[model samples]
Target chain A: MGILGVILAVTNLVVVVCMHISFRQYGKYKEHMILGVTLSEEQVKDDEIQCLLEKYRKSFRKYIIIGYITGILVIIPFEWYVSIALILYLVWMFGYIFLIQHIYVKYHKKLYAIKKQKGYTYGKIVNEITIDTKLSYAKDKMPVSPGWFLPSMLVFLIPLSNKGVREFILSNLQMSCVFIGVIVLVKASYLLIYYMFAKQRSQVYSGNSDINIACNRVTKRGYSIVFVVASFFDSISFFMLLWDEIAMGSMTMVGVLLFVVMQCIIVMGMVVGLIQIKKKRESILAEDSQERVVDEDEFWATGFYRNPMDNRLLVPDRQSDMNMTLNMAKPSAWIWTAGIGIGTAVLLLWTSVVMLRLDFVPVTYQVADKFEIIAPSYSKTIEFDEIQWVTLLDEFPDIKASKQNGAATDEYALGRFHIRNEGTCYLYIYHGYSPVLELQLNDMKIYCNSREDGVIQECYQQLQEKLSE
Target chain B: MIFHLNMSSETPIYVQLRNQIVLGIGRGDLLPGEALPTVRQLAEDIGVNNMTVNKAYQILKSEGYIEIDRRHGAKVAKHQKDDKEFEVYLKDKMELAAAEAKAHGIELTQFMDYCREAFGVNEEA
Candidate 1:
């Protein structure tokens, strides 16, 4: 296999390894870490929780072993399709994880019910731990400042100031700045809002209040650091795209590699941070004597959280304090759920449509007082009066361009592209199909060709006849 | 003022919001001409639909409990002297309450006492 295939295989292997690690860590945390209860108290009520954890762990371990073994076995013979194998593995892993989580949740709910019935109290020694308001609401302890992301806008200026860069942005970097800007804005908003509202102490537990606050502060700082690091990586990526050498040829393979590495580092960083925070919190809890464990029975189910009793829509996820989960009872939650469901369905449908169009759709051109070009994703009609000039070219123009819409492959170019010299042009030319007809319209250009050379000639003759008339 | 909405209640959210605002006004918790949270802000905070909050605001506006401006969103309306129309409306509502109380076997005096307590008015001579 080629270098690309080898790289892909290695990446796939790394991803599988990461997934295994993450799942194992999550399972470990779920099994051992009782959120409110002390270790001694947890042991007292551990019958069902222990049974559930054992069952889940056994199944989880079995699945991972089978999955990895199968993946390795498949990769041995069909290494070229390593990426596909990795995807299948991922699907299997996620499906199993979901099933296990569901089972765990079911068992947990039953256990919680039993505990409630038996009058099992968690950390009932109420000790009022007075927390300094400054510690609770410290600005420095907040997550990444939104201001750190504003520098990303400098990418726009890089293109605007230089002529070569302007052409690159208009053609190569078309709307990428807009996309990146939107992402930065969204991340900034989410971080800012989450820090401002969601990070507030919901229920201050006894003895561990200081520890809880400290944990939150540390986690927030970690998230901020992660965000800053991610933003820095994004800036690097944006700059990488500006390199003309990288923009051309198989350098995109290198870019993909860099992206994969960045993702791995980020994921590892987050996991380590989470594990560290959890360890610290557990240590603090172990040392503390006075603990107040509220009955969190109605609040969480399995891993999923939904409290009909709680009025708030966005609640902190039980598994991860950093993330938010919908309170399913809320009207807004239902709306958001429906919206996401519909959005996913629509995306799947659109993707299917695009695939079908790409495979089956043919380019068609006609002249009836006006010149019109039609393809699956690219379609345009040019007024006869607006036609500036028409020329037949034997070779494809070596124009630097970026696709605005439609497909541009080695075999054919069927898209709206912002060409360096030609401006915005609709291309419907097969690379092998010689003698392409070029139309220079009032404000834009059109390149047209057909699979059959005779058809192109016929279209050219017809266009000439119409122009003469 | 913090509004507590019972999601499980048979009463609609808009009606609950309207009732709460009216109760707040009656309890002197919400002063006349006091600015209320904008419909969007209230809806987001409560995690309800914007239209639900808007509907509540509309009800308040029609009842002269709040006035809505394009720039300022919604605010409590300035207190006006009790008019004959308001007295008629109040009488109509009180009659309905009296009928309900009678159906429930509540005496007229007890119902009046309950109303007086709710209104925070002095016991009659």
Candidate 2:
């Protein structure tokens, strides 16, 4: 498979596997919650509920297997539909999240119907808040102090550690500052989430206050430890980018590898933590034998926690333990959601614009008072006196270079690319076409080329005439 | 004592909170001089406005059911015999309840039995 095909296939596999595992988790009862719905002890043992779950299991398995195969088929159009593959995959991935939710919700509705038919809902929808007063004190300790996060901020020191990265950062201090600032912001955001979890209500899982306190301790520690440790893990991704600044073009993809790895590991760690807390809570309750849980079903009857009566800004997601969703009851939640949505749209729009331009826009040379090369997005002018020499390159060289900035596809390369030995080159070329015109300047090289016959030769003559004058 | 609050009750949040605490004290679930969660702590736990919890604590303090001081924060007050103020409050509540019971054709003995059931259930615990 080509790079696009490889990306599509791998992403498809990961999504399918993850969904398979998480989707199955909804089949079992966790804290008396199933498919975002809460149940009572007696309802859990009912024959109709068991039968409904069995029915859902069969259909869910069949749908998932079919979905995986359909996703795999996305690779078929890789070579022929190269330009659209990324956009296609992105659209598919977006829909995939929703489609899975749709399937889950379908079963949720059926279960709801059965619940109403059998009068299984034990109580009215109410904003019920449960708290162990002793465990809910403000002076309660965190798993680790804020000082633990100081180490995560050490991501700034990474570029200075490596010689090549140090030189790169020194050369462009502004870019380095931006990179460090982003890393700090991400770490700070994680810390904020940890703060929210720390301030969360202490659930009273049993009548014995000590047992309830222990359950809260384990749950808080599980989530808190993961967030703190995960923040430190991010430093590795920053180190990868620093290395990418120096590594050859072939190894440039190493930058993205650590970042993707960090994301996958942190997400998996959080899931593991969730499972650990759930199991431990169950075992502790078993020993205590005085199980108690509040019915906050009204707030969580839907996929979201939306209780205007409750003033919390964030709450645990009912459907998945992997996320802490904004409490829709708060105005700040709407603002945050809108902000994230707009930011994502703007980012996607910028990327799609660049990709489309790189693929479809042809580069053209205009011979005038000064030589100008124009691509759709930008144009560059070179004075006749600036060009020291112009030569027709019979074939493009096999020199390796790292892309500092700009966008690229298989057929074209544009913008600034850093060559290991040659310093820097401004590229405006159809790399596959020849003869290429290499315009040499005092301190840099500008490469220009086209697909049509004699275009480079004609441009070369015009540049020579201007230079001869 | 653990607080179980219902936001959907026709009663206001502060009233519900105040009632729960009073009941906890009556049932000996909240022992005399036991330290209660601070207003902010209770508010955070219930995801309610801080003032709502503060109002509940203030009412408890005024009624002599709890004491709020800087050092001890809000703690259950020492046990006290019912006073004239409490008796008047009780009479008003009982009059309304008794009128409703009379409307439902409940005898005085049956009403006394209901009161015993209400008071005895928690004492059994």
Candidate 3:
């Protein structure tokens, strides 16, 4: 629990720091835009505007200090209850996100107000979009072919080649499906993002077709390469699931943590790629001496691109992801927004509830017609006919085993485990408790005990009586 | 040359596109025989309806500023021919603009200078 708490603390700190830095970046000019408002090159140098930008930076930094302090105070102390600590940590993350977004919008509006006062975009063709006709005529080549996805898909399927993985998956089809389904969905969404980026209006930087082509080519290629590289990261988790079933140990948790680390690595790679591409585009922009810069600030007055003129369903967000935002003018955009909103809510709720259950629900047993042992999400029932023997041991079996699935913590292990001498068994045991009841079934063994010592003894006695009759 | 378009502008989108192209040509930014993007491509890039671009191309073609070929798409014409209909329309449009300029307290000399500047002429010239 302490180790997990420390890891969670580190993750929280990283997220908070990243959020602090990334949100601050929006205040600077990029692609001729600053704080979601477009500005003239001359206006960008204005003293009063610079002061406001300084305030924008300082304001977020001040808020971040408080957020960081609060996160440390809330997440670090409650390390004993890992579930509670995790929930608090998530809440802190959500709170920090809300805080940053709120601060960003507040400053975005302020910058826009200053822009209005300066008449930067006023009495002007602020909705100007520079398109290099020649470049447009020779349509941009982006979006990695669907064929590129086959290698990652093959890696995902590689686990099926192993006999243990196949049997494990076959026996627990639903659980495995849900797990695999999540990974597949993530990959599918990324592919969708890639397609949207391809379909998106290419960034037309200058009248010079060559400059425009160079800028857009690097941007698109950078995005394509980043997604392609990250596409293979998920395949590692597949082998992680089956590593323990063959070589017996707590490899599942290690695998999950490794997967997380890989995810972080991919995100860092994307950031690096973005930085390099931006530098390249900025360098090439110097060549095209006379280029029209767009200032569609009115459309993005709310800090989101809401252009009715832009026919594309998705647009590259000025923030983190390339295709994270919707073109609000499209009616279908509302459906997409609602879907995202609902999906996020469902995932958050499901995770919180699952975590809470793992910490609170005690191991339980009922022996009526069938011997049912249940704990949180991991539960199993053994039929009376299948049970060949039942024994109530005074001492807990100190057997070497590994968890196949379920919650494992310092307190208990409640799930499927493969015992070294006993083969596969459904275990519902608490470390603090003892004298567990063991049942021998046709193909598998069951070891479970209740929190109440008397209740466990009663269950064992009743099972024995029922079996004799 | 980059075409600056504003959806909320008083001028129609197609007219904005047409004016930019004409300016590019007069400024020599768009050279004679230089190819233009096809209607579909331009429309897609600018995120406008295809008809808007088609209208601009048709106007440019009718005024003898460009030639549209099935294979080569639209290309800037080597020579801009004088058309009676265009002269008449230009006269009417210029008269209205001059009237608007007068209302805005612009002198005839200033208006002439602005017009000359529009034609890419220096004050000394």
Compose the digit string of candidate 2's lDDT tens values, residues A307-364: 8867678777665544678888889999999999899878877877766666777788
TM-score of each: 0.62, 0.84, 0.76
Clashing pairs in 3: none
Question: lDDT by residue for model 1 over A244-342, one digit each (tens)?
Answer: 322462235566566556556655666676667666666655666654454454556345566675566777666666556788867899899899979
Ranking by DockQ: 2, 3, 1
Question: What is the DockQ of the complex in model 2?
Answer: 0.52
Task: Report how far off residue A275 is in candidate 3 (Å).
Answer: 1.5
Models ranked on lDDT? 3, 2, 1
Candidate 3 segments exceeding 4 Å error: A2-7, A29-32, A40-51, A66-78, A118-124, A128-130, A142-151, A154-180, A233-254, A319-323, A329-335, A368-383, A394-405, A415-424, B4-44, B48-125
**Best prediction by DockQ:** 2
Interface DockQ per candidate: 0.03, 0.52, 0.42
Candidate 1's C-alpha runs over 4 A off are A1-21, A29-54, A61-163, A166-190, A193-198, A202-209, A242-253, A260-264, A291-295, A388-399, A409-411, A430-435, A451-454, B1-125
The local lDDT score (0 to 100) that residue A411 gets in candidate 1 is 54
TM score of chain A per candidate: 0.73, 0.88, 0.85
Sorted into a CAPRI-style docking class, model 3 comes out as acceptable
Instruction: For residue B36, give model 2's deviation from the true position in Å.
Output: 2.7
